[model samples]
Target: MRKANSYLDLVLNPFNLFRTKRILNINPTVIPQRKEPESINLYVYDYDAENIHEERLKNVKDCFTYKHSNRVTWINIDGLRRTDVEVICNHYGIHPLVQEDILSIGQRPKVDEIEGVMFCLLNMLYFNEKESAVEVEQISIVLGEQFVLSFQEDASRDVFNPLRDKIQFRQNKIRQSGTDYLFYTLIDLIVDSYFVVMERLSDKIETLEEDIVRNPNKRTLARINQLRKEMIVLKRNIAPVRDMVNGILRSESNLLEERTGKYFKDIYDHIVQANDLAENYRDMMMNLHDLYLSNVNLKMNEVMKVMAIVTCLLAPATVIGGLFGMNFDVIPYAHHRWGFYIACSLMVLIPLVMLYIFRRRGWF
Candidate 1:
């Protein structure tokens, strides 16, 4: 069997190439740069039934002042500089491993409960239209008794603006609820943004399907491979998040109230739905790949068929020409004037007879 040409295989089967080569020794602790550089900004806000106070802390020391507040405090520290995250973690009593995970932006999505604090890690995903690729940022949230600390890798964009609006406008129960509810709202916001990404992918898939049908070329194959890679990344990021939500639902931690389980469950359901959509898109992409290969093969077969028919029709002329051009002193057509006309007639008539036979046999 021929090997299938697929980007999915190249991504999923990394070791396949190393089967005949020696493995390299490399350090696993090194952090790779995955995003553009941005300045660190800290935004702290506390809200209650009657009032909301927002503060922009200049130094890490000032954020510690709100640690013991009675209201629901949300401290969002954007930009994950190593020293800055270490300082914030020290002040907030975050676990060392959790801090490391936060600093290591490539960490997978997970939930960890240590020393009465709930640490949840998730990916914030968006489609970059200019680059035609998916952009991923890591978001780490720590839920305590009275405060929720969120660390974001990128400071440029956030998916929690609508939730922030709801809190500022006093439009919902977010202010009345505890920090657990606020945590749930943040997660819900991230999961909801997955649908936006899905919509964009769906649009691209539709356009690609049309293009594959109308004209399959190198450009179309490149697009199919690109979409396949994006879907693979989306699936890899989302699957662990779903597991993290499930972990949250199964936990009996006091930081996450029993009442909040339903909201997390809702987020879990949405994640499942998103995974289903990704699976469908993956299957469709595989089918598109096969469709592209089939189109190419069919086109090639058509060209070969036409060439074969032309060769069959010319075989008789080639044979006749070779026979009359022999270097004999007395060839049959070399002496008679009528012999050349007869030989030309025979060549034309022979090819015409072969053409008729081929047509009648449905070879054309």
Candidate 2:
């Protein structure tokens, strides 16, 4: 019931999407930086409206230096280490529970306030073009009064570089705003990536729908089923995130500045759009399933039609042969010279007449 009212407030305004979705077209990609195998990477951007400093820190303890910095700081950890996350959370006054959520991978999307920090744990979705599937990377963010700490499951790639560029090259509102706005920007980018993924999946569904129309075989059926399952995963991830956004909106956490409310609301609207699109796609999958079944039925009907016509054409031959082969039969004209020829001719001619009639009727 609460969820329903929250959704009522969350209108999927496309105009707002155009203004808010800053990175939808650019595509989220890795910047191709090399890292040691299985080692944690810590990158920090300490910035304010006037000045900014970016660095790659060698130690987790280096992040503590920005804990109380006057400027808004964003500490992005590409890979997760339990001890490192714990130490940072302890110094930053984040609750143990929130730290656990950050360290754990594949946590359900949620929002909560603990020890004056706004924490969000959700999946950062990306489209894998090569495999033609959605790939999820768990992202957990802890937004404090002056800093935002983000933990990503995979170190290879992420959707944050575009936001980084906005901070670095461009003098955007994100740089001028506080940690809460930074938090909203991060959430907004993740939501925008959802649209990217949905667009790709939509293309696949379109192509598969056409294939189902022209020629749907066992392999095609399998592909449809696989996409349907992917839809389930999407709904599961998206629905909760919508609720999570609502939780953020309703929170009275001081860490989330009141001015940032509008930005977070924009995220809510985009998420609703993604969730609704997911449902539309699910319905499309069902239609595709029904289409595949219908085409298979049509093919079966064609085979049955041909078999019925062939049986009709052979009936005269079977009856003609049966009459002559009867044991006690005194068949009329059985010994006649022309009798055998007439019977054979009738057998051949009757089928031809039936086939001609069928052709005129357009049965095939």
Candidate 3:
């Protein structure tokens, strides 16, 4: 249902998306320039709306300070606004096509290695209470020998917070390891989030299943539809990440170290688990739909039973009324003093006889 809303909003309110300003500010925390290995230079920075006032262009200069290939470099662009993104793209020697890919806000998770640098686009998502939905941003990471660069369409979330902690914490393998490990850690974090969301979805499905069995109605159908839509969106996002992880496992590129391969395998396992849960939920949804239909049929049958009983009871009454309604002067009941009493007696007895017959037949 959110996907449906997003599509409608994109078509009808495309202009408003820009007019609506983001409250979140981007303050890029760029790593201080370090001595370059004559062959490799590495640089990484994070920028968004908040810090835009003090150091927008200056951070690009910092990114350029490390320019050698022997060292890996990383640059993270947090905000997706055209002006903010274009300025850094210009400084980093990013291709027009790559810039175009970055500009596309709905870009799916993918990795493209260009020349010596590996460019990766990923979705960073978290739930927003105000919006009542998952908020997603495009994250672009550029990996070069000696450095890795990451970009975000917004600054509100620190998608790499764990990775940052790992890097800063002493004796942590991330900082002591190569850029590939840093890359794996970042992907691992995103993949880990899928489980968090899947757990929530599983709880919802369990509740819905109970509701369906107890009282399947319009509201239950609505809930099922909503869950179905959410599952679809999750599947769409998670499927590619699984394939991308598998690609990393299969690729001959040195970007994925053999030591780190096991972790990627672990991420792949999570994806498989998530996939299984999604499939189970889909089956449950179908069963619920069927259950709703069955409930409706049962209600209709009850209604028909009541109507049939009323018609059978009313048949004798109609005949008695029609007989008394005659206008002929020779009618025996019309001349009789007990006419009214006889009519009442017949009407009461007729319904009793029909009721007894119905009870014997088990029609009630």
Superposing all C-alpha atoms, what RMSD in Å does each candidate have to the true structure? 6.6, 11.8, 9.8
Indicate the residue-level lDDT of 134 in model 2.
68
Tens digit per residue, CA lDDT, model 3, 1-364: 9999877875675433332232122222433132222221222532121211112343455556555534444455555555545766666666766766666645567777666566777776565444323455567777656566676655556556776554544466654667787777777888777777777777777887788777777767766666666666666667777777777788667666788889888888987887777678678778877887887788889899999889878888788888888887787776699998998888889899989988999877
lDDT of 1 by residue, 1-364 (tens): 2245444665565433332121122232777554534567899989898889998886767888788788899999887777788898888888998888787746779999998899999999999885456778889999999999999987889998998789886657897789999999999999999889988998999999999887888778877877777887678778888899999999989887788888998999999999999899899999999999998888889899989888887888888889889998988767898988888898899989988888899887
List the candidates' TM-scores in order. 0.84, 0.86, 0.72
For candidate 2, the 10 contiguous residues with the lowest summed lDDT are 19-28
As a whole number from 0 to 100, the lDDT of residue 292 in candidate 3 is 76
Candidate 2 clashing pairs? none
The CA lDDT of each predicted structure is: 0.84, 0.83, 0.65
Worst 10 residues of 3 by lDDT: 46-55
lDDT of 2: 0.83
Rate residue 262 of model 2 by lDDT.
85
Q: Rank the candidates by lDDT, best first.
A: 1, 2, 3
Best by TM-score: 2
Candidate 2: Cα lDDT at 75 = 93
| Per-residue C-alpha lDDT of model 2 across residues 1-364, encoded as one tens digit per residue | 9777545534443122332232132222423232324688899999988889999997889888887789999999887777777888888888988876776644679998877788899998887785455677779988888888998878888988889889975379887788888888899999898888889899999999999999988778767866776676678778899999999999988777788898888889999999999999999999999999999999999999999999999999999998987886588878899999999999999999999999999998
